[model samples]
Target: MSLLRIVFKSLRQHLLSTCITAFSIALAAGLLMSVWVVREQSRRSFTQMDSGFDAVVGIRSSQLQLVMNAIFHLENSPGNIEVEDYEKIKAEPGVALAVPIALGDNFKGYRIVGTIPEMFTHNEYAPGKKYKTAEGRLFDPELREAVVGSFVAQKLNLKVGDEFEPYHGLDFDEDHAHDETYVIVGVLEPSNTPADRLIWIPVEGLQFMSGHREESHEELSAVLVKFRSPLAGKTLQMKYNQPDGHLTMAWPIGAIVAQLFDKISWFDRILEMLAYLVAVVATGSILASIYNSMNERRREIAIMRALGARRSTIFSSVVLESASIAAIGVVVGFSIYLLITTTAAQFIRAQTGMVIDPMEFHNVMLFGPIGIVLAAALAGVIPAMKAYNTDVAQNLVPVS
Candidate 1:
């Protein structure tokens, strides 16, 4: 028989152990690739996150929270800044454009943000990419029409002609639905940004909503600002970042996100280390599994030699079995990766407003699984050599 046939026979004889060995390797490989994917994909998403905004102007509070809540929609607002404060930021020197957003309501759990048509008119939400109306025109600020994000439309089954009343705050409760209903005038193409989950109406419309009051009246959650030139960012930071300043600016979304990831980088490293440890355990499992079966197979090896099979043939069969397990395990591991990433992709997008493509091929493909196979092959060395050295004279007499 060929080496593969012999290998298959041996593996079939030990089905349970073979499955356990393959699955352990698969788990280790999946864990390794998963960690690599999260690290790389998140890094890429962070870099491309938001562009064209020089600064995020908001009430004095946690700068990280301000940026995350205002741009990414990942956190709650620290506080609101009045419309006057928003306009003041817009009027600041070197400020070329400022889009105001007022948040305090939700439409079935999706946030209802009040912003001017400039949100659709500006390319700053993403660098050089303007928001395109997928179905209808941008909502007129004079009316109570709304524009929904792609995800919002998909999740809520909303269309341009649909009209819905928003609830108070972020909870998806019907009891808090306000008296006023807003018509959906437009649907935005997927921008892969937080705005995709928002129900954007006129800033004036939000101010007139039920939660509005003098304290939060005409107040904005944040002013997304763009400078006439790159130099304006330095001026905005130097001037407004003060302990007594009513508002602060967080500029160049890239830096803010970098800082955020840097803080959690250690956690990623720990995961990577754990992945390696799993791999080590998987290798040991393969080694122990093959080693323990060696004694039982010694007589078979002796009989193979008695039947004129070469020592090298027995060795090759053992090695092939180990390598086969590794190969199958890697494929299983990749399948597991696909299942998880595909399942979580939409969820991650909805929660963090960052797009994660599970199938976006990465460099990890070249190395992670290949390393597992090599480790598995190495794990078979002792077993393969032991099988090759079987003594036909000593073992053939004992079988009876």
Candidate 2:
């Protein structure tokens, strides 16, 4: 019989243990690949995030908080800037566009942002990519009409002409819903940005919503600013980012978002270490499974030796068996990776409107599986050496 046939026979004899060990290896490989892909893609996506504006002007607070609140629709506003402050920022030198946004309410947990019609009509969220509606038209600036983003519409099953009331605050509360009813006039096309998860209304609609305190009506959450030139941004950054200034301006939005990942880098490192530890444990399981089976296989090894199989042949078979199991695990691991990444992508899209492309090829995908196979093969060396040192004469003697 061929050496591969011999290896197959041995594997079949220990099929249950083989399958279990291979499954452990698959889990390890899948987890490692998933972590690396998420880490790299998240860093890339966040560091390059764009939100139609060059800078955000708000009440003096953390720049990261301001960007997250204004651009990403996350967290509470630092505090409101005055209407006069908004107008002043708009009139500043080099300011090409300044749209005031008021944020305070949500519809079924989806944020309801209030901004001018000019935001969708004039600005490009991405270069050459203006916000377009898949259905109906932009909300009228003077009316209580809304333009829902594609993601929010899909999740809420909202359509044009459908009227809904806004709930007070970012968190949903059925009892605290405003008496004001707003009609959905448009549904925005999916832009794969944070805007896709927002519900947009006229700035007055949010600021003057029924039950809102009168003081809140005169306040603005932040002003989204677009500058005509880079020098203009640097000039204004110095103007607003002063200790005596009441308003904070966050320029270069991407770097502000990138700081978030930098602050939480330690948590990322923890996850990476856990993944490596799991992989090590899984590799050790492969060694233990094969090593513990060696005692039972010694008589078989002796017989194969008696049948003229070379010692080197027995050794190579053990190593090949280990490699073959790992190879099978690598194949199965891809399925696990697909399942995890697909679920993660959906959750991320729902929460942040960012698409994570699992199909995108990364170097880790190429090397991760190969490294596991090699490690498994190396783990087989001790057992292969045992097979190599088998004494045929002693084991071949008949037992009483």
Off by over 4 Å in 1: 307-313
Candidate 1's TM-score: 0.93
What lDDT score is found at residue 352 in candidate 1?
Answer: 69
Query: How much lDDT does candidate 1 score?
Result: 0.84
Tens digits of lDDT, candidate 2, 179-262: 999999999999999899999999998888998989988899999999999999999999889999898899899988888999
Residue pairs that clash (backbone atoms under 3 angstroms), model 2: none
Please tell me which predicted candidate would have the highest lDDT against the true structure: 2
